[model samples]
Target: MADKIRVLLAEDEPSLAFIIKESLETRDFLVSIYGDGEEALAGYRKDSPQILILDVMMPKKDGFTLAKEIRLSDRNTPIIFLTAKSQTSDVVEGFQHGGNDYLKKPFSMEELIVRVHALLNRLELPVNHKEGIAIGQYVFNYTRQSLKFNEEEEQLTHREAEVLLHLYKSRNEVVDKSVLLKELWGDDDFFSGRSLDVFITKLRKKLTKDDKVLIVNSRGYGYKLLC
Candidate 1:
């Protein structure tokens, strides 16, 4: 068998932590569990893992602080935050602290596995000219949060950039509305649904400069960006 994917899971809730650790281990992942951020950070310093799964509300040190510390030493390792906090500011802070993805409480094991695989797939990709994505004629530099078109440049807001990146990743495939809502906004409530609609509309207008770009809505399904 291939070497297992190393995961540093920092979660204070013992029951939930055990559940997550066991689930990942069942899938052949090598999980190093920690009950607090301080211990997790110490473990991180000793042996950096391929991925980090952190709970936001932890003792000794919060996940955000630990993430900042990790970011200072490594920028490419994928970090996925698991939290119960659903506030927009909290989610924004997670990303600002170098989180690659976020999963709210009550998420299924299947969803967790899917997200972990997706992050790993992204990490395994080669560092080449194709590192970023192109939406129609607009060049989206994910790392820089900038979009350029015909010598004109526009900076995307955090939400806008995240939505665009997810759309680009799905490419020609239909991205389910629920998936978009959950992945980007961390919820599928009515307000989040409306917010997603607005962002999609804005992205469509931004890419309208190129006639080849189209963000097609699927009614009951989701949206697709075809170039």
Candidate 2:
């Protein structure tokens, strides 16, 4: 039989971690759960896992600090940040520090499974492969966090790059406001919805440099990238 995908989960909440661990196990994933960041990091060093699921707040080391530390040594392992803090700044910080995905608290097990698979699918791509998504005449390089148009290049903040990339991926389709809020801020609450609006406005301003590119709003529904 094929070996199960090994997962290291670091969540301070015992019950939550237990639930997550059991769910992953039922999916045929081998999971090791830890209640603190320090112990989780230690566990990581002891037995390297295919992926890491970390909570932002923990008793010892925080997830951001832990992810930063791990990035210094191992840059390839996918790290998913789990947190209740759904602020835009917090989300950006997680990506800047090497998080591949973020999930807000009170998330469903099904969503967790989908995210895990999505990340693992990316990892399955050829080594050293980088995707530069095209937006009008501009090419957005996600790995370098840069957007290029002709000879000019704009370096995007981690959050900006992520938001733009997602919109570009859903080009011509209305990406629900809640989707962006949940995917980026990790929540679809009122505050996150407001933050999503700010991000969309910011992206619109930046992409306005290209006449053919427009981020269209769907009134009460969502936003779409029309190129």
Candidate 3:
């Protein structure tokens, strides 16, 4: 059997942390859950995991701070920030501090698993890989978090980047809202649902210049990224 993907999850919420840990473990992932960023960082130093799931607000140290430290030690290990903060500045700060992905609160386990697998897949790719995906006339540089339309480059927020990348990867396919919520937010509650709607609106406006790119709403079903 292949080695299980090791994950270090740091969240102050006990119930939520338990759910996330159990969900990941059920998928054969070796998970170490911590309520404090300091403790999680300690465990990280002792034995680095394949990925780190961090909550933005925590005691001792925050996710952003820990991420910076982790980056200093290990640049390649993937880091996913789990937070309730949906502000554009907060999202930008997360990516600036080296967050590989960001998930808002009220996400579902299913969505988390999908993102985990996606990050792992990207990490497993060879270093020389440089294929930039084309979304309409824009070239999305997933590694650099830059979207280029014609000669203009737009820097995407962490959450925006994750959402866009996932959509691009699932091109011409229907991406269920529940799946996206579960993967990105960890819970599919009302607030997160609203948050997802806001992001979808923002992304739609940003990609409006390209008539070929469409984020079709499927009413009760979910969303479809049609090219």
Question: lDDT values of the candidates?
Answer: 0.82, 0.82, 0.81
Q: Estimate each model's TM-score.
A: 0.66, 0.68, 0.59
Instruction: Give the true-structure RMSD of model 1.
Output: 4.4
Give the alpha carbon lDDT tens digit for every residue of 60-177 in model 2.
Answer: 8999999999977776687899989967789778877888778888899999988888767655533332576678888887666678888898877556766777787778999988
Report the number of backbone clashes for model 2: 0
lDDT for each residue of candidate 1 in 73-118, tens digit (9 for 90 to 100): 6766778899899887787688778787788898998888888987
TM-score of 2: 0.68
Better of 1 and 3 by TM-score: 1
Highest-scoring model, lDDT: 2
Sliding window of 10 residues with minimal summed lDDT for model 3? 122-131
Winning candidate number (TM-score): 2
Off by over 4 Å in 2: 1-3, 12-19, 42-50, 68-79, 82-111, 118-129, 143-145, 150-159, 179-187
Candidate 2, residue 219: Cα displacement in angstroms equals 2.9
Candidate ordering by TM-score (highest first): 2, 1, 3
